[model samples]
Target: MKFAAVLNRDGGTLRNADLAALCDRMCQTLETAGHSLSIDVVAGKDLVDALDGATSRRSVDIVLAGGGDGTISAAAARLMGTKKALAILPAGTMNLFARGLGIPQSLEAALKSFTDGEIIAVDMATANGRPFVHQFSIGMHAKMVQLRQKMEFGSRLGKIRASVKAAWATINNPPAMNVTLSIGKAEIAARITGIGITNNLFGEGHLPYADNPAGGVLGVYVTVAQQRTELLKFFFNMARGKWRDNQHVEIHQADRTVLKIHSGSSKFRAVMDGELVRLDRETTVEIQPGALNVLVPASIAKAEAA
Candidate 1:
């Protein structure tokens, strides 16, 4: 396979080695197995254009984009409906999308796996017209991203530190949005603090997110907790797969959903694969089932190892 990669130089844990040196090592490792690989390093802001340029090279069969969920989402924007496949190198804070795809956390392991990967059609969700591979969410999750942007931390533990601080800062003065979620004939009217519509059902465990990205259904997760204590409890239980048993949070599976601000029409911030999006009074979410062709472990069993 002929492959090209764009690395997010400022992505999580990217300072471990010099950028060019690392790309050379990756090329050597893949080339040793008789596969061709080329990599380019880009700042997070430039990744979109870089992926566009790399994908334009018609000879490249796969494009590897390394970063967090935000970077992967950006790549998916260009790769969707294209003939080429996307290969992820997990180099982000949560690496949620990569983990959901069962890609290993180690960059080297991910590269090796891709060299032997199979092309699988995965689900991609769109809110309005924007594409997200993992999920699109509003309320608390979106606020956390906004807070993290303004805060700084040590490069070594920056991701962890920023997360803790962001959470602490957002828990109080929680987002107050009264929305009506319409799924088929069912309509839910609630004042929610968080709403997450996933591309597929997430696996249960500490992280509690989808491990299989190709599942053709959308999982809708909502938080109805109004009190600070209730909000904390809701997330805690969710991390343990105990949210289904919690009254404050509701999890459902659907093919499509429509969400609108029931009380007042206002523009708000939404989190799409870890990126913030400003949405109008109403946003529609639908699954573009099998909208993306991407690299995944050829062996079914190994692909769910996240």
Candidate 2:
């Protein structure tokens, strides 16, 4: 098969001596798997267009994205609904989407799995027409993404620090957002601190299916924690995947939702996949299932079959 490997060298740390070496190893691994490969290292936002060119010109069968969640989200946007399949390299912190796919974080291990993997149809959701593979979130999680992105130590602490810092900041200044949500025939309103719409259901302790991305529904989680004590309880429940146990948090499954947020005295940040986006008083999220084809470890597929 012909493959286009789109790697983002600057997606993680801006300075690195191993960039060239990592690319070389990736190339060698794919070529050894009997694939005709074309490689490019995306440095900035413009590289998305460049990657589009490489894949289209080569008539690539698969595109391997080597970056963090944002880079993967960018490449996935281009690859979604196409005949091509996407494989993640997970060079960035968190790599939430990659972890969901059961892709190994180590470059060599991931590349090997790529060659051994099989393509699976997975759902992708859109927020205001923007594609997100894993999740679209509003509220405290969004603020965390924003705060960590602005921090000078992003590359230094990697994903773990970014998560920790975001958690800390969110706790310090929790969002008290008044949200009006319409899901299907139900019109509901509440004052919430955060909202998450997931293509595949995943929470702090829950395990999303590794082999099936096309679950055909979106998981919507609303956080209603408004006070510090309530927030602590919310965290405790999240650790056990029993967040729904808390009356402060609500979970629903929906095909689509229209949301309006009254930010009031505080700012609102929205995170799509892992990218931070700010929302005004109103925004809409629609679930578009089977929007992307992904590659997953073959073993996962067999497990599902059994």
Candidate 3:
């Protein structure tokens, strides 16, 4: 297969990486495996353009995007419903989407995985017609991301620390809004602190990312905690992957959902795959089963199939 690799120069761990050496290694690795590869290292501001250019090429079969979750999400959005597949290089803080895809977390290991990777179709979700590989969240998660982005963080560890601090701040002063959730014929109205709609149901373990990206449903979680203590407990349970046991959270699954936010503010913000964006008063969220083609470690793919 022919691959076009786009490395985000300003994303997470890649900010301090040797791009030239990495590109050389990628080319050599892929070529040795009977595949051809071309690489582009671009600034964050130019990432979208680079991705667009790479996807537009007729010679490219797979686009190997190297960066954090946001970069991978952007690449996935560009490749939706297309014949090209996406290969992820996890060079970020959490690398949640990479985790869901079962890609190696380390750069070197991820590169080697591509030598024997298999292409598989996975589910992708969308918010207001915009594609996302991960979750679309509002309230607490969005507020935390907004707060963390304001603080200076150089390295991956620094970013994690900043995120922890932001999470604590959000927990202390959580935002609440009137939300109407519509799933199928059922409609539920509630005052919630936060809400998240994931691409698939999050598996129980260490992180909140989905273990089965091929699950053709959206997982909706709404937090109704009002007091600081309740909010703190909810977050604690979520961190321990015991959110299902938390009474403050309501979990539901659906093929599609409509969210209407009744916040008084004219402008609202939400987090879509870790990037903050303006939110519409009413947003339609839905899962597209097997809409995205991704490259995963061959062994993992075989094991899952078995």
Q: Best by TM-score, which number?
A: 3
Each candidate: what lDDT? 0.81, 0.75, 0.92
Instruction: Spell out the clash pairs found in candidate 1.
Output: 202-209, 202-210
Candidate 3 residue-wise lDDT, 119-143, digit = tens: 9999999999999989999899998
**196-260, model 2: which lDDT tens digit per residue?**
88886664456332234666777888988877788778766765667557898788877888888
Question: What's model 2's overall lDDT?
Answer: 0.75
Per-residue lDDT of candidate 1, residues 45-82 (tens digit): 78778989998999999888887677788888889888
lDDT leader: 3
Please tell me which model should have the higher lDDT, number 1 or number 3.
Answer: 3
Candidate 2 vs candidate 3: the lDDT winner is 3
RMSD of 2: 2.6
* Cα distance off (Å), candidate 2, residue 124: 0.2
lDDT of 3 at 62: 97
In model 3, what lDDT does residue 293 have?
89
